[model samples]
Target: MQRDRNQIIQAENSLLASYAVRQDETGVREYPEAEHPYRIPLQRDRDRVVHSSAFKRLQYKTQVFVYSVGENYRNRLTHTLEVAGISRTMATALGLNSLLAETIALAHDLGHTPFGHAGQDMLSDLMKDFGGFEHNKQSLRIVTFLETRYPSFPGLNLCGETIKGMMKHGGEYLGSHLGQERKEEGPSLEAQCADVADEIAYTSHDIDDGLEMGYLKLEELSDLHLWSDSFLKVKEEYPDLGGKVLVRSVIRELTNGMVSNMIRTIESRIHQWKISSRADLNFHFQEGKRIATYEPEYWEKVRELKSFLYRTLYRHPSVVVTSDRGRDIIESLFYHFRKQPDSIPETYRQRFETEGLERCVCDFVAGMTDRYAEEMAQSIGFKSKEA
Candidate 1:
């Protein structure tokens, strides 16, 4: 005997907390369609995101290092997967909708430009007059108007909740593209899980990548409370641990510790706020209360770690040079297509009439992988031998 969609949804909802968004509230798509026979809306949304071209292109998009930096470094795709996994664990532990959390995590970075933040910063600077570039908003644009798979819909036609979460991912919601209905409710706990998962994934993995690249050393991280605490615990557990294996274990422990801390914090907050239902959560948000957070001291430590990474790893001379080259490639490509609109693909050129030439070009360039961007740059005589 197999359970149908209705039965499955009931069974799943039975386990969720009152504050969790119900599967039924996955909300409507921009374009209406028949529901799947077995899959709930959030699950269906996750499948659609997985199948999107933007998700696939994350393979070649940068996270912290250029794709050419090393095969071992985390690319955008890997980071997204890590975030999704962590979010599922956290959401499930908190009795929230794990599928919704995972879906948001997977789709969160869909709009990241090639070459990571470097590409995005350059694009933002160039588009300042037209409308500024934000990866979060770009992601919303991709799902809403850019992707052209369905005959009737221009974008993925994702659930309104998913779209809202994307825009709310990094506080980029400016009431520009989405309607008031979608923007009224604050971010769900599932969305909060994705946000924290993203931070945990990047912080831990950057440590791993930084160590691997010889850009960061264990000795340097000793002063950071998060690292130092996790390191000591790992060392105490495995006194004989040494070298790469030890470092990997420490990173794993760090990630685990952060997830556990978040779980505890959320649980504490729920009880303290007396949040028993969706309405309660919404009321809290309306009152300017936020749920997803670390304890004050822990958050300060996390902030300290972030500051350390920004100064020591992200701004390292080698990483900066590599990121600079990527910026140059994007800059050259942007101007090249702007000067010669015909140079962009015929599909994008068609969008120029409605989307405007600058936006159309921005979309085309934003969707490029590091490798493809370099190829486009080389075609126009922008030369660079470095990664």
Candidate 2:
């Protein structure tokens, strides 16, 4: 269905991704039964993620606090839901591809290790000799191959478009040492839209979470750089909007500024970097290709917000100490069970014994819950409540 102007991003020319998850019309139609009763193509993407074992395990995965003695803190699952909400809202307003945006947001952290980035870093260090470890690529693996829904397909069989967008964070993928020449090029408009939405969601929500956790005060946050510019004007204009209002106002500004850059870059055609449209994701013009850059001041605002979170929310004493412990728990769990393999879960054991150990170990650690982490730790004598 063609989206209305106010709804999803509509492109008369928006081509489909290089592949699709359930592309075979005949196969989807005859897959043992029935029709999907949804209007959006990504609804299937959403359903698949929701039903997956990995998604359920997100309840134990850390966003900030890990090994929480209580259920009050935000887990990776809650964070993903928040990101989806904000991403959908921003995409709706910008007329970006909301379904694709939501899909990327939903799958962004599926590959995250047991303790989040801390866990990721440890695994990356351990797997340096291998292909290296990254949550984004892991998300793709989970959806496409690891999920056990279909016998014939190795993964959940997601289409190409959503997978592409989920991995392509910017117009490109910038990691450890990959320079301008070799970095995987940027994302489609759909993927780019999701990236922007992720920023908007996490920045605001993390601040809110920090305040709730007593790691930050509202007054202290007002000192952050985002308010140094036109914030007063926006506040006066939308006095009753509160945090929700402030978040939308700030996001709208950032998005508009960024989109303006994208338009200008595309039109000027002095492209130094390649941005993928429907036709090409990695094609760079030697003469007329460039990446979009936002205003420095605007960038400062974003940096300050991120820095504030790094200091007060993510790096806060409570958040850090707990996640540090969480790292030990996951690593210990992985090392111990990875040897026996069969002690973890029947499916995981079979997968490990069959598919090789690393991925199976990934699957086992990825499936644990918060309590399960503690329980495993206690059982292994790595941790004891009495300690």
Candidate 3:
């Protein structure tokens, strides 16, 4: 006999720890629907996210560099995939819901603006009087209202837990879609894993990208405790490693060390607190205790590496020039649409009556890919800042 949804849930439950989210308790949706016969709720949520148009747009979105910078650089789509892979590995090791972790990771960056942080910061400043803009809230907005697919629902109508997990930066979302109630409780172990996974993927991969782009040097990075430790280990293991292979090997070792240390640290916390159920986890969460984190000494090294990247890679002239162009495109588009709302797609134009013109314009601009935004800006008679 074929395994049905109930059988699958049972299997999942058997594998999950007491503190992990139970499959049965999840899947509460805004628009109620019948459960699938074969797939569990989280699996269905993952599929819905994967199928959404917003997810597809990530392919052209920036991660650290603009999409046009290079074919091999990590775009938002590749970064999301890497986060999902790392989160899944961490969740499985901790006996948490790996599927939930992966789903959250997949949907985490669906609302990132075209030029990464540069676009987001510009949009935020432009919209400051209009309630401001943040990617996390934008992500929630996309899944809840922006994405119009189903005839019965305006959004994907993903599971409640999936939505909550996607709110990695926890705070109050102003819109009625998420309500005004302040969420004080911490997220589940799966959500924490996904959040940290994002950190690990970006920190290590950004180093690789910096090296590849010639913006960062190996000698400069050797001063970082985290990089040096990993570099030494990689060099000891592969005596002849050089060039791209050497960089990749070092990054792999760095990633591996971070993941292993994070898992071990979280496991130690779980035992130290004697957390054996969801209720126990909630109790600690209510007490403002963080269950998932690296040891302080190790975390200091990670922070050092991040600070180095911020100073060296992110502030590089080539990257700044590209990001500045992207910001100009976004800002130009924002003003253009504000002046003539009709230029926006009819779908977004219709939102003007209900969500106000500025917000509708912001939503439309936020959804554009890097190249598309540039194209649209040119079509609107806007010139590059450098031009």
Which candidate wins on TM-score? 3
Clashing pairs in 1: none
Residue 2 accuracy (lDDT) in model 2: 50
- What's model 2's overall lDDT? 0.61
Error of 1 at 17 (Å): 0.1
17: Cα error in model 2, Å: 15
Clashes of 3: 0
Model 3 lDDT per residue over 51-134, tens place: 999999999999888877789999999999999999999999999999999999999999889999999999999999998999
- Counting clashing residue pairs in each candidate, in order, gives 0, 19, 0
Ranking by lDDT, best first? 3, 1, 2
Task: Judging by lDDT, tell me the better candidate of 1 and 2.
Answer: 1
| Candidate 2, 2-74: lDDT as tens digits | 5543232223214233211122211131123333443334566667778888888887887766646446767
Residue 179 displacement (Å), model 2: 18
Instruction: Write down the TM-score of every candidate.
Output: 0.96, 0.72, 0.97
Of candidate 1, the 10-residue stretch with the lowest lDDT total is 169-178
Question: Tens digits of per-residue lDDT for model 1 on 238-306?
Answer: 999999999999899999989999999999999999999978887787778778888889999999999
- Model 2 poorest ten-residue lDDT run: 20-29
